[model samples]
Target: MHSWPTTTLPELPDTPARREPVRMFDPSRQAVVALTEPGQQRASMYVCGITPYDATHLGHAATYVGFDVLNRTWRDMGLEVRYASNVTDVDDPLLERANATGVDWRELAAQQTALYARDMTALEVIAPDFYVAATESIPAVVEAVEYLLVHNLAYRVPVSETVPAPLTPGAADIYADIQAIASFGEISHLDAAAMTKLFATRGGDPDRPGKRDALDPLLWRAARAGEPHWPGSGLGDGRPGWHIECAVIARGTLGDAFDLQGGGRDLVFPHHEMSTAHTSALEGRARDLAPAGARHHTHMGLVAYRGEKMSKSLGNLVLVSRLLESGYEPAAIRVALFNHRLHQDWEWFDTDMQAAAQRVAWWRTALSGYGGADPLVFLDEARLALRDNLDTPRALAAMDAWATRTLELARDGDDGVAGAAGLVSRGLTALLGIML
Candidate 1:
């Protein structure tokens, strides 16, 4: 059985020094918010994991790297963070890709998920405290759906007329009551037309038969012929929908009101909005659960390649494994990623890679044969920089300034310069998750 975190709520620290908070731009609030509460050293977070079809692209890496910094920053501040993420191991994209390649969906999901795990490890992303896959958490999903249904927040309807028949018993489309949640469209600020259009493109069948509203998202999808099935009391053989998967996994792992929720900027729309709505509705029905507020919602910026977004559809994805095979070290990739603000979208280029490689080389030479000093003093500058919304660029600049000073001192034959440089190098590696 998967071990779950204790349901006991976290307490705020009594000491003022421990209350020193880190601020971040919350997309939900549309302003900067304190991510850590005064007197609190515990954080709960959930990031939507990959579907594992086309796994671990640079864009994907960029998002995880941003959140990894969040995790690192919290820990650096002496906080105990419980982070959870869900793997959409049984989603439409996986099935479609598997069918196209004539491979079993299970085989494809396992292969790509393994690849993603390897890529995350290569990039030195901190593993989530509780990582659950969709297939693994189906029962939890069904339970949540049942909760929603009992509360009249969800209802079953006929499957999409678009999907040709031989639909199984539990195959009906279960829709969430999108209207029940206040501030439904506030997160994305998408107009009706835009929401409808985006929904159709990103996992919503706007034209599906019996949908209550144009924006009502699916909670449970009934099984179809030749698709994977999980037997359930009322959910039928069909699996959970994309949005519901995050809601259930997060609630099951992190409980009702987590400290933070993060994902790519693209998820700001139907995916995140729907997840929040589902959680909100569920919270309303369960009186014991806190009214999960508009908490700190952070999003990593989109990464582009050439003139366009690096998407699987574009066939222009720059995979992490591909870059590694081309002889670029993972440290170089980490440096390149931190070259910009985590929330800023930028294009990937050869110049970025070259500059990062140069930075890594410089650090290696500067710290060579240097007996280490207390890394705390050297890390203080980075800590300040990162406190300002994970300002990696500013932090990198600080490291650069220190490196220049160390080089000058070395040229002057100062005995203390080597130790200082070693301290700075180690601090950078620890803070940035990039090895020196």
Candidate 2:
């Protein structure tokens, strides 16, 4: 598993006010729900991670930062958060990018994955309890595919491709029978036409002549020359498929009925939906596509730039490392992101960084002097705002109000206000994961 230092949580003051339970918007339910069940102290979540083909982009950072805030909020509310995530270290995109750049795929994945870890560390994201590579869980993946094939949830289909050294004639690839799942559309909620269109563009083979539905996801791909292959337990000499990777990893780490399944909004359709389906097939009963029976499907909004969503394929990436190298403070960049709601679709502007820097400067100035307003008020406001759907802008506005009050009243310099400013600053760090 990938590792990083633990972000220490701020301790409660002499009298930490009773905190409200965290409530996040669940897209599947179309309603805001408590993060954990009643009387439940421990919460489990699995978020999909990057494919590790390139540097960590701002879009990528935004997702992690948003969830980082969520992680902080949960701990503040006194819930034990067991978070797990995966790096798709052996996917098609990594191989394609490696081939295009003439670098070994393994080396490319390693270099980029290390860079991603550095960016996350610089941003101070609390690393997951289980941050594993897909390659690390192949034995578990094989067992999952074995379960699916045994229960008749997956089938084989033929492909016509040339290889330098061929062994089996009419080599067949295994596909999950989505038709067998009772809750295929519960998560995506799309009609056949929309699903088919999206499947074709989003790492799917809609045009492939298959024996089942066009939406049936690949379970095992037969070995192809010049591509990485793994033992597939008699299915063929190919690695596990995209959705199955997440299914096996998530189920293996978090177990069944985890509290939340989270990722960027783009993964709602094929990735999470099909992974959830695979989980259902493995467990041998449908939880309405709540695979491993996740209670909530929490998806962060997409980040867009220059009139299009920021994506690797588009090549309009604003990398986090590049911004740091350009002399932006990590705290300032985090404040810029905090200016927007986590679930709102917003575009990035150059001026955003400037504004965030100015905010951080003002905050530091406030912290250096004595203030009048009760520091607990700032703590209460930030926690309340963030606990509800991660309304970061509201939380930021509360901090600004506290800072403005502090600066405005510094001339009266209450020596009795010992550590008042420090309390508020630490509250900001603890509640919002912002370093003031």
Per-candidate TM-score against the hidden true structure: 0.91, 0.96
Q: In candidate 1, what are the lDDT values of residues 1-436, reduced to their tens digit?
A: 2312222222222322223566888766778888877678588899998888876888999999888887877876778889888889998889899999999998988888888888888887888889898999888888889889988888889664454453663357688888777767767777899999999888898887677898899888777777887876776766788998888788888887888888988898888888877888777832323225336688888888888988887877888998888888998898899998878788888688889889989877767647333334457767777788888988888777666666666677764533555556546655678777
**Backbone clashes (count) for model 2:** 0
Evaluated at residue 243, the lDDT of candidate 1 is 90
Rate residue 348 of model 2 by lDDT.
87
Model 1 lDDT vs. the true structure?
0.77
Candidate 1's displacement at residue 236, Å, is 2.3
Error of 1 at 81 (Å): 1.1
Q: Considering summed lDDT, which 10 consecutive residues are worst modelled in model 2?
A: 12-21
How far off is residue 16 in model 1, in Å?
A: 13
Candidate 2 lDDT over 1-436, as tens digits, reads: 6657767888756334335667888767778887775577888889899899999998888888998888887787678899999999998899999999999999999999899999998898989999989889888887888788888888888766655333456778889998899878777788899988989888998876865888988888787878888877677677778999998888889996788888898888888889888878788875353444677888788888888999999998889999999999899989998898867778888789999998899889888764446788888888778778889999999999988777767756644356788788788788777776
